[model samples]
Target: MQVIDADTVARATPFERLVPALRELFASGAEVPPRQVLTLADPAGGAAVTSLVMSAWDPGRYYAVKVINIAPGNAERGLPGLHASVLLHDAITGVPLALMDGDAITTRRTAAASALAASWLAPADAREMLVVGAGRVAALLPAAYRAVRPIERVTVWARRPEAAEVLASRWRSDGFAVTVATDLANAARHALIVSCATLATAPVVRGAWLAPGSHLDLIGSFTPAMREADDACFRGASVWVDTEEALVKAGELLAPMASGAWRSADLRGTLAQLARGEVHGRSAADERTVFKSVGTALEDLAAAMLVQAAAG
Candidate 1:
């Protein structure tokens, strides 16, 4: 197995390549099997284990699997909260083709997916962006926004004010106007709102703060217990998702469904439909839109394929 580090993966995978690859994978009718997640906790020992396995298949030849292990206590020691590995295999022969670091793959592919959704869902003239959460996704949102829209400024918000300020300071040095907002509502007032947090309860962004012509990307919630956007947010906007099945498992959507404000059938359409021209996206410049992503395995497969190609 060839060990690929985060820097090498970052250099090899660009949004230009990964987005188009994902579009092709969607166009070719690829399917990601249900992801498997396992969690273990021992209260007295203060140790927990969380593992995730995601896999997807292309038409005839290839399949990929990404396995991740996450433990929460590492952050106190200045280590990543999660560590992962990805494996690519030939479908017919079941031969392992490549092994790579999954942490970089996760961040890049996720940001690329959000960018792809924004490109198709947001108004063509979007310029300002608001990113919530100061972790990996917040750092990536600016780059992803620039790839899809002409982002002129970015505002960041996090639970820890210092973390948000630090992220804003770095972005300002990079030539973009960046600000750190103490309030989530203020941070979410921009043309685009991107949320990436792992908090298990309560909504970080309220629905009323979203302006017309805003595009909201809720990326943090994956399980049935976590949420970033409130039910009112869904009630006030048109919702689109990367896939229908994935959305069903997404906490951001499931919460609203339980409240009766949203129905499973209320989903506007899939990203595939928009990409294929089957559904109209952002019908008017002032329409409110939201894209809730649960993160798909197909995205990892698509991005991994691109990274391997670029490395060649």
Candidate 2:
């Protein structure tokens, strides 16, 4: 079996390469079973941690399972909140083929997925963006969005002002007009694209602040208990998700799903359907659009396949 590390994954599947791979995978489709998100209790009565298992296969070709560890309290220990690994296998023989850095795969694929969805959903001339949160995933959004759109200006907002400034300075050195924003809603109103990746349990982006023709990409909320956008945000826009099954597990969609404020009937369609032309994207320039992603197993499989292909 082969082993792939974070550096190798970074070198192999840069967003430019990975985004197109993700696009192709979603457009074509894959057999992805339901993803498992388990929260195991801590014996010491501490904050519980989460484990995610996502499995998918291309049938005759390969099968893969990605295991992710979500430790929110790790920040207090000066560690990353998320760590992951992937095991790839031969579909027919069921033999182990590779062990990979699933966190790397996740970070790249997630940014790529956002960029892929943005290509279809965002307006053609979107030049400015607002990226909420200054974590690992947040660092990748600028370059990823740039791959699909002509984004020259980017604003980063985080709970800690220093973190936002640090992230902004790094991107600025890369020649992007990146800045730290004090007001999220104000930043949301001005940008052509608003990409959110915070771990907030409450709404960070409100509907009232969004301007016309803006595209909102929600990437943070994973569980039904976490949300980054208000119900008004969905009510004001034509909503879409990475997958319906994934959305069912996300709190952003669940709140409205329960209240009937935003139901299946109001959904534009999943990214796969949108990719295949089964559903349309951005009918008008003035249309407010929201793309909420809780991540997907198909994306993990697609990224793993791309990593192997790149190595060969």
Candidate 3:
């Protein structure tokens, strides 16, 4: 069996290509069961450690499982909070095919999924993008969105000013008109697409600040305690998700529903339905849309298939 790392994964499935592959994967669908999370109590009395197991399979091709570790306290040690490994096996015979870097595949596929949704929902005339949070996902999101839209400028916002500045600098060197944003409200209002990937428990992106015709892409906040947008984000906007089940996993949707601020019926549709044209997306050029995603194992499986095929 082959062991694949980040660089190899990159060569296998670039974002632009992965976006189309993700579209096909979501459109066709797969067996995406609920993820399993195992919690380990810290012996040192620190924060509990979390290990997530995500698995999915397409009947004839292959099945894959991802083991992801989340150690939040590691940020204090200047380490990544998320890391993972994934295994892909032949479905019919159960033969191991490859071991892949889960973090790398997860990050890229997450961005591609966002881009895939944006292709269907984002304004056709979108020219600017505001990416909240300067984490690993933030660095790659712009390019993915730009692939489908005409984004001319990119702005990055973070809790730490230096982090935003550093992220902006890296993108600017790549010939992108990148800027560090201090005023998130102003940045969000002017942009056609506002993509937020943050761990903030409280709302960082206000619904009132969003401009008309803008699409809000919520990528982070998977747990019930975490949320990135306020209640107003869904007040009247057409809300959508990667999957209907995502609402159960993402606090961004669950928190409001728990407080009676949102309703289950408010969700217009899932990406799959939209892709299949079973439900319409963005009826008007000036309408508001929101796409919320809590990571799914099927996306990882589809990504692995695309990457594995490319590698072969």
Candidate 4:
């Protein structure tokens, strides 16, 4: 079996290609079982860790499984919080084909999936953006959204002011008009698209702060305990999700439902429905839109296949 590294995966899947590939994959469909998310006690007596196992397969072709470990405390140590690996196998023979660096696949595919959702939901002239995190995934969001929207200006906000400045400087060096925002709510009010990628148990982006016609991308919260946007963010907004699993797993959605501020019937549709033309997106110029992603196994499989093809 071949071993595919992060650099190889990055080279294989760019947003321009991966976004459309994800669109196609969602349109055509695959067999994906509900992913397993388990909380484990840290043997070192630090913060609790999460283990995620996601699996997906295409008939007669391939099967892929991604194993990811998330340690929130790693950020304090100046290290990445996510460590992941993907194993691909031949469906018929059940033979292992490759082992891939899942972190690269996860970040790219996650960003690409957000971009895919934006293609349908974001306003036609969205150029300014507010990024609500300063992590590995947050760094890629600007480029990903730019693929679909005209994104000209970017503002980054984080709990750590210095970290936000570091990300802003990097984006500035890349020729983007970037700024480090000390006030997140003010930034969200003025931006055309607000993309959040934080791992927060509490709400970071409030609904009242979002301007009309703005697009909100929530990528951080995956468990029932994790939430990035408050219940008001969902009120009266046309909401879409990457998959149906988010209904039960995402706190951003669950909290509102529990509070009677939102209902499951209010959901506009899934990304697949949008891709398949079964649902409409951004029906009005001044409509508020939200796309909540909890990650999906099909995306991991799509990204892994792209890397495998590129490596071969």
Per-prediction RMSD in angstroms?
Answer: 2.4, 2.0, 1.7, 2.3
Error of 2 at 150 (Å): 0.8
- Residue 38 error, candidate 4, Å: 5.2
Candidate 1 colliding pairs, count: 0
TM, every model: 0.91, 0.93, 0.95, 0.93
User: Compared with the true structure, what per-residue lDDT tens digits does model 2 show for residues 1-312?
Assistant: 999999998888888888888878888878988778799788987668999889999879889999988887888889988889999888999998889999898898899889988988999998889999998899999999989999899999999999999999999987799778998878888987989999899998888888888899999998889999888888868988999875668899998778777877788888899888899989998999999998888888888998888877
Q: Where in model 4 is the C-alpha error above 4 Å?
A: 38-50, 71-81
On the 0 to 100 scale, the lDDT of residue 113 in model 2 is 89
**lDDT of each residue in 58-117, candidate 4, tens digit only:** 879889999999989999899888899999999889999999999999999999999999
Scored by CA lDDT, what does every candidate get? Answer: 0.80, 0.88, 0.88, 0.92
* Tens-place lDDT digits, model 3, residues 13-78: 887788888888778888988888899888998877799999999888999999999998888889
Estimate the TM-score for candidate 3: 0.95
Best by lDDT: 4
Clashing pairs in 3: none
Worst 10 residues of 3 by lDDT: 255-264
Candidate 3 local distance difference test against the native: 0.88
Instruction: Give the clashing residue pairs of candidate 4, or none.
Output: none
TM-score for candidate 1, please give it: 0.91
